[model samples]
Target: MAVPGWLDDTRTSYDTVAVSYADLLRDALAAEPFQRGILALFAELVRAQGPGVVADVGCGPGRITGYLDGLGLDVLGVDLSPGMIGVARRDHPGLRFEVGSMTRLDLADDSLTGLLAWFSLIHVPDDEVPGVLAEFRRVLRPGGVVLLGFHAGDGSRLKTEGYGGHPMHVHVHRRRPERVAAWLEAAGFTVEAELTHRPAPDVEGGFVFAHR
Candidate 1:
C-alpha cells in the first residue's frame, strides 16, 4: 500500500537520521557515479535551455535542488516528507522547500520550465506513476524538460534505509526503458535521451530525459 500517513512524520524520521549520520550518507553517495553523471547531465540541459525556473520533485534534503540552483536556475524543492523538507530548509535557507506530494503538486499549470525527478518515483506504486506523470505534464510549460530516474527491473518489493535506524519498504515496480519512454510520450513529453548505469551497491537504475 502507498504511504497514507502524513509526510511530516516520514520527514521527521529522515531528519533524525541525517543529524546522526550526515557524513555517512555523504560518503555513501560518493560511490554513485551513475547518479553523479545524471545530475551533471541535467545541469547541462538546464544551462543549455536557460530555463527561468525549475522544480525538483521529491527533493529529499535538497541535494539535487541545490545542484540545480548552483546552475543558476530558479529552483523550488518539493517533497512529501516533512523531515526531508525540514532538512532541506535548514540546509539551504535561500531556496524554497515545500511539503507536497508528487501526485498532487501545489502549483499552477505550465508554471515550471523544467522538472527533475531523480530517484523520486522508485517508491511510488506502479499504478500511480501515470497520474504523477500527468501532474508533471500539467505543471510544465511547453518546451519544458523532465529528467526521471528509476530502478531497472520488473515489478518487485524492496527495502532501503530510512532515517534513524528505520527500514523503509515499498513495492518497486520497475519498467524497461522503452516502456517508460512510451509512457512519457503518451503523457506529452518527447524523448530526448536515455541511459542506464549501475554505479552503486544495490542500485540498478536508468535515467530518461524528456521534453514537453
Candidate 2:
C-alpha cells in the first residue's frame, strides 16, 4: 500500500528534527504540574486494572514513554519516524521503541491495554483522524484505555520550521475536545474525561481519556 503524502511529510519532518526535538522537550513535563498530574492520573488508572501492556504511540524521543516506565507501567514506545525511534532508543536504552504509524498500526487485534498519543495527532489532518481512532479501537482490548493529547483549537496550520530552525513540512491540526470525543464515540470508545490546559499563553493543550 502506498503511504499518504501527508504521512510521509510528517515522518520526514520529524526525522529531520528528532535530535533537537528530543533535547528541547526532554524535561518539558517537569515544569508542568498539571500535565504531569494528568499523566500520573492516566498511569494510576491503568495500574488499578492490574498488569497490562501500554504503548505510547507517536512517542517522539521516548521522553514520556520513559516517564511512564518509571511510574512502573510495562510501556513501549512507537512512532512513525525512524529518526525519532533511534533517538528514543539511544536516550532510554532500557525501553522498547518501534517505528510505526498510528494510521495503520502493526499491532494485533485487541492486543493493547492502554495507549497514549500525546501531541502526535496534531500532524494528522482532521479527515484522517477517524481512521486513526478506528485503528486505535481495533488494537485495544475490550476494557482498554486511551489517552490523547493535542493542541486545543479549531484550525490547521503548516509548520515549515521546527526545533532550532530545522526545515519541516507538516500541518499542525488543532482540534476541540468535544470534536475529538465525538470521533471517539463513533469509533466505539466511551469518553471518560477531558482536560484543557494552557501550557502556554497562546497554546491550549487538550487531553481526552476514554475506554473501549
Candidate 3:
C-alpha cells in the first residue's frame, strides 16, 4: 500500500521520541506475559531453522534483533523508519541495524539464511505483500525460512491508529494465515508450521513459519 503522507513526519517525530519509545516497549514487554510468550515463540522459530544469518524486518528498537544476537546468530535489524533505527543503534550498539524498506531489500539474492517479519508487514497494502514476500524469497537461500507475524482476520485500515504514543497515525492491514501462506508458496516458499495467539487482551494473530 502507498504510505500515507503523514508517515514521513511520523518518522521524523519518532526520531525525536525514539529513546522514550524504546524504553516504554522494553519495560512493557519485560513485564507483559503475552509479550514474553510472543518472544519465546520467536526464539523457538529461529532455533528450529538452525540459523546462520537472520534479518528482522521492521525491527523497531532492535528488541528481537538483540534476542537473536544473544543466541549467537548473526542478525541485522531493518526498518523503514530511520528514527527507529537510530534508537535501535543507541540501545544496542553491539548489533547491526539498517534503514530500508521490506518491499526492496538491498541484500544480495539468496544471501540470507532466515527472515523474520514481526508485525512489520501490517502497514503494507494487501497487493504489495506479494512483492515484499518475493523480495524475502530473493534474499533467502533456497531452503531458508521466513517467519511472519500479522494481525488476524481481514482487518481494515480504520481499526488501528498510531502506535503507543508515537506522533504518526499507524495503519493496520490484517490477513489470514492461510492466505499469506498461499502467497509464500506462490513466491516459492514451502508452507511449514503455523501458530496462533492473542497477545493483547482479545486481540489475536498468528505466526506463519515457512521455508524458501
Candidate 4:
C-alpha cells in the first residue's frame, strides 16, 4: 500500500531534526508534574488490566516509553522517523524502538494492552485522525487504555523550523479535547477522563484517557 503524503512529509521532517529534538526533550517530564502524574495513573491502570504490551505510538526519542517501563509495564516505542528511532535506541538501549506509522500499525489484532500517542497526533491531518484512532482501537484488547496528549486549539500550523533551528516540513494540527473524545468514542473507546493544562502561557495542552 502507498504511504500517505502527509505521513511521508512528517517522517522526513522529524528525521532531519531527530538529534536536536531528542536533546531538547529528553528531560521534558522533569518540569511537568501534571503530565508525570497522569502518566503514572495511566501505567497503573493499564497494568491492572493484566500483563500485555503497551505500544508508545509516535514515541519520539523514547523518553515517555522509558518512564512507562520504569513503572513496570512492558512497553515498546514506535515512530515514523528512522532517525528518531535511532535516537530512542541510543538513549535507552534496553528498550525496543521501531519505525512505524500509527495510521497503519503492524501489530496483530487485539495484541496491545495500551497505546500512548503523546502529542504525536498533532502531525496527522484532521481527516486522517479517525482512521488512526480506529487503528489504536484495533490493536488494543478489551479494557485496554489509551492516553492521548495534544495541543488544544483548532486548525493547523506550518512548522518551518524545529529544535536547534533545524529546518522542518510538517503541519501541526490542534483540536479541542471534546472533539478528540468524540472521535475516540466513534472508534469504540469509552472516554474515561479529559484533562487540560497550560504547560506554557501560549501552549494549551489537552489529554484524553479512554478505554477499549
What are the clash counts of all predictions, listed in order?
2, 0, 1, 0
lDDT of 2 by residue, 87-146 (tens): 999999999999999989989998888999989988887778889999999998888989
| Model 3 superposed RMSD (Cα) | 2.9
- Model 1 Cα displacement at 203 (Å)? 3.7
Top of the candidates by lDDT: 4
- RMSD over all Cα atoms, model 1: 3.0
Per residue, candidate 3 scores C-alpha lDDT tens digits across 144-198 of: 8788988877766643324465454556677888888888889888898677776
Which residue ranges in model 2 land beyond 4 Å of their true spot? 1-4
**TM-scores for all candidates?**
0.84, 0.97, 0.84, 0.97
Cα lDDT for residue 108, candidate 4: 95
lDDT of 4 by residue, 38-126 (tens): 99999998988999999999998899999999999899999999999999999999999999999899999999999999999998887
lDDT value, candidate 2, whole model: 0.91
For model 3, what is the error of residue 167's alpha carbon versus the real structure, in angstroms, after optimal superposition?
2.5
The lDDT for every candidate, in the order shown, is 0.76, 0.91, 0.77, 0.92
| Candidate that beats the other on lDDT, 1 or 2, i.e. the better one | 2
Q: Count backbone overlaps in model 4.
A: 0
Ranking of predictions according to lDDT: 4, 2, 3, 1
